[model samples]
Target: MQTRTYNHVDYLWDDTKAASLENDEVALFLYRSNILGSDLRITNYGGGNTSCKTIEKDPLSNKEVEVMWVKGSGGDIGTLTRQGIAGLYTERLRNLKNVYRGLEHEDEMVGLFNHCLFDLDSKAPSIDTPLHGLLPFKHIDHLHPDALIAIAATKNSKKITREIWGDTMGWVPWQRPGFDLGLQLEKCLKENPGIRGIVLESHGLFTWGDSSYECYLNSLEVIEIASEYIEGHVKKNGKVFGGQKLESLPSGKRIEQAAKLAPILRGLCSSENNMIGHFTDEERVLEFINSNDLEKLAPLGTSCPDHFLRTKIKPLVLSLDKEESLDNFNATVQILQPQFEDYRNDYKEYYEGCKHSNSPAVRDPNPVVIIYPGVGMFTFAKNKQTARVASEFYINAINVMRGAEAISTYVALPRQEAFDIEYWLLEEAKLQRMPKEKPLSRKIAIITGAAGGIGKAIAEKLVAEGANVVMTDVNQEALKETTKSMGKDEAIQTICDVTNTTSIEKMFDLSCLNFGGVDVVIHSAGLAISKPLEETTMTDWQLLQDVLVKGQFLLAQFGSDIMKKQGLGGNMVNIASKNGLVAGPNNVGYGTAKAAQLHMTRLLAAELGADKIRVNTVNPDGVIVGSKIWEGEWAEGRAKAYGVSVDELPSHYAKRNLLNEIILPEDVANAVFSLVAILDKSTGNTINVDGGMANAFVR
Candidate 1:
């Protein structure tokens, strides 16, 4: 059960600015819509619609005419701008009651909406234009609030709605939305002149008033009544629903489980060209998954119809136990591997059942939301942001089902109706308008030693190119600040000690959870230890081997596993040293470890070629220009070995190369991006970013 008092707070609204000699009607409309959109409790992402009727002068006609400005299709209400709402002549749209009384083609209805537009270049109006056009009030607000739908979808809910709002609220039975539904609302108002709002069974609530603010307030008040009724009547705590007590996971373990499960789920759903991330894990989510009735209720279709386009009618359910049992999760993963194929097959069957001869092309049959016991639940999409959007709507749907069970059974539009909306031409057009993805857009990249230098530059490059990135460093604070500057939306920062197997595996796991699967890995993590054989201590030799030799093995091993499971070729870029090829004086330990890395890269290339995974390395010489690696005593020591001042050491190295220009981190990043993102024909090669060190060049 849920209890929320609808407070009529005008958020982000500036009345002083609105009143200062401008179009107050449109201003007030946008202001109110933003306030509602800003609250996910009322509407989410692109769900819901708002409209206001005003008399404005038609420039060509030279006469003031009634206009209905409504939220256009495919734009979010939270960020609705002036260009987002479409303006149409109210009389022209309403007059369609005569011509379109029985007009059945929704495509034609959409065309008619554009035809009646007061401004031809204006954005397209919402499909619900007919409903708003026929309403008598000057302003109308229609929100798909969870609480409102919870009450509306319950048994005898219409009676309860009348008790709550008395004659001020009306009830409309479920009907396919078109001219007929719009006529329903018009008749409701005429029959009950004092009605403040109308609750549509199996749909949502619609409210209207003389002013935008009043209309907004009416919406809030109506939702408040529904929320109170749910709180008072529905069960809230302890052993009431779900049957068994939820087996809760500790916060730490929950993250670990999700990290492990993400790649498995994403791998099952992915392909050579497209990737979908398993990107959700929350405490409440785990509880819902653990419920006994979860499988029964979660897949019954969405209480809010708008969510069908994002979350689909239901989810793919996998069975297991609590999150703490990693062994059970792994075992379940093995079982679910073949089962996922069945889910996709069933999805195709569902599509085949409802699709007509002239219907839109059937989309990929993979379910966007996946539910499993040990893994909780996850939502997937082509990218992280889209996955997050689906996750939000899915969670809302979970709550709707929960509320429905608490009061009465949750009734939703039949599966056929849902398919119609999901495959709508206008809805499909919105997806078509989305910008084409960059080459690496759906790819996930993991960058080691990402706190600074070549690694940071490469991470930034991948992010700019639309690859979802997970950056790792031993320095937690530096990693936090570095990623913070990049923003949280596209990147994830982790503290990974490359020398530790547990740390390395955890880093890969986090990347999978963040971006579905790892498609590219850049291993630039290393320690530079230059010492003569006589002076090199066992500690120094061991440290270099630990960070470079062992680190490369673990990274390639873990990364290639994901790529193999996904059956998609991936890229691995290892950072090596020119010292590995042509040893300089007192560069024993460093050169030995780097030589091992080069050989390992070649070995990986041979072994993983069957899977189409490419392995390559960049051998750089003294290109520490943009990193802090050469800033302190290490710089002085290297300068002393070169018999030059610290300031002259860079030039000394640069002059020895075939090309005299000093190499920068950006230069290394460009070469790395070339091999990983641009090049597709070659692997097992070393591209030197050393400005052409003649002695170290490899054939």
Candidate 2:
């Protein structure tokens, strides 16, 4: 093999970090894995495995035994920790070959892995464990680097492998990952005594060495060489993806078109269940989507099992006519609906043709990925992270296709083989082992005024129920802090001035871009001004109307548009006040605005029922604790109006109510949650979170 300089991947190893952990082999193995995983070019998220062999004292025998530490199933090497590694008895693993019933019974070996556990508390070992334990080296790295897979996924992969590294690297034909493949690796290494690594056709690369440092270097070297060779060929072979056939829309236009298309696609594809959506116009994605080969190549599917499993068998390609414009979103939807139906029918056919007697039942027939010619890619899944990761994996597949086509004809895994991996009994078992889905697992919510106590509480509650929230507020600082408190993957923050229609549109665009489409809209952004009729100024009245009444209208108008396009039933909760129904002293501007908000909810509920959009009101009173409205002039004015100090207002208002209880932000949140999640059949109604305000009761 030629010794080439590193160009594509970084040599991230630090000698200082390595020397400190020289005494501990497991720590060194983790360090190697972390640095290698830090680069996506080395391995995709949770797509590869690594292992180290160490001598440790046996817990039972009190004697030294060789233990193999490999990455556990469902763990990502990038953020791997000690607890994430599965420690197995190396001797026990080797002895399993004695009972092996060949490739037909390879899955049974995964269940038997528990018996070989060196530590009872260790994580479950992955299927790739045998590939690591059977290897003769002390350290090994198995990665699905794009460059290497580019070579592996070609029609003439073996021929290309030999030309790239000559005899220094070994090659294994495509096979499902199991004990059989592990035996193949051991045999390949035994035959090629001095080779550094072996490239698994249509799979990935396996490299090993006697020490951790040597193994890390071997993996990087193989990836770097393959990257260089592929780039050289791609540079010589000018046109990629048969060259771009459609001109890409400008960036802003692309986002506009994507925002409009996402919810419609999301709605059409979410017939079986609710799905979160993610939109990406990344350069590579646009290049492929705009290319002539997109229809030809995407339908061929992906070569790697990891890639297709996340992205589905193929992406639904959204083709547009020369006369069609995405701005006419309704017309575009007319085209998409039929195309989606055809795709689902084709998927069912694919399942019926390939399913075996014992194969798991057919899964969701909707395509997880959708590609638009002039726009970008839209991916949908049960959650935000899954949708995002699916997009990343498809991008990886795009790169693989690019490189393979540049050097030779790109080839995909056979349909039967892909089907076997997709519906494998073990894969089905793993799916069954997953924890039950949370109530709101696939729901996406957008909360306006989320920086305030009520909005923040609502966000927290929704997220706790497994909803992804796009928390929007005019207050940037508070919004940042509130979004930070939630899981970063579940919540995202954007500054949205609800009074501004453009800002509201942009916020919905962001919601579609981040978490797919909006399923719930919480209209909580408002202000309070307490004064007698004479003292109230035009400014205060106009501001209240704009922020409260108008803001709620625009938010609902835009939000319901997305929900209607999504075709899934949605929820909208308007946080009105008890004052909206009661005639209260020194409250004119705020009271009228609240009444407008309350009535608007009813109007929207009645009008939007045809689309299955539920609109409701949650009325709260004396919510002084942790409320942003209470921090301003509204608290002092209300206190003065009731003849009490600001500090005494909570108890005074509580006593005024029949129940004599102090209402809180959490109370309002609970009301909203109940209406949306529990009161599935109720809409155009009002829920009172006040401490029994009989005077303000809904009539």
Give the Å error, residue 537, model 2: 0.8
Worst 10 residues of 1 by lDDT: 1-10
lDDT of 2 at 403: 91
Please state every model's RMSD to the true fold in angstroms.
3.9, 2.0
Clashing pairs in 2: 267-566, 277-516
TM-score of 2: 0.97
lDDT, model 1, position 450 = 89
lDDT of each residue in 346-381, candidate 2, tens digit only: 999989999999998999999999988878888999
* Candidate 1 lDDT tens digits, 1-699: 112444422244455654662467887888788888887768788888898988989998899999988888777878898899899999989887667636465556777888789866678776788889999789999888877777677667787677777787899987656677898899988998888889888778899889876787678777766766666655454442466445656667767777766776776766323755756667556657777887677768685676667887778887655443544545656776777778777777878998877677778777788886645677788888778888888877766666766766777668888887787666677679878988678888999998888888888888888888999999888888778767565899999998888998888877777777798999998778666789889999999999998988999888887776666779999999887788778778888999999999999999999899999999877786877668776677678788899999888988878878888888888888899888887899998889887888796
Q: What are the Cα lDDT values of the candidates?
A: 0.79, 0.90
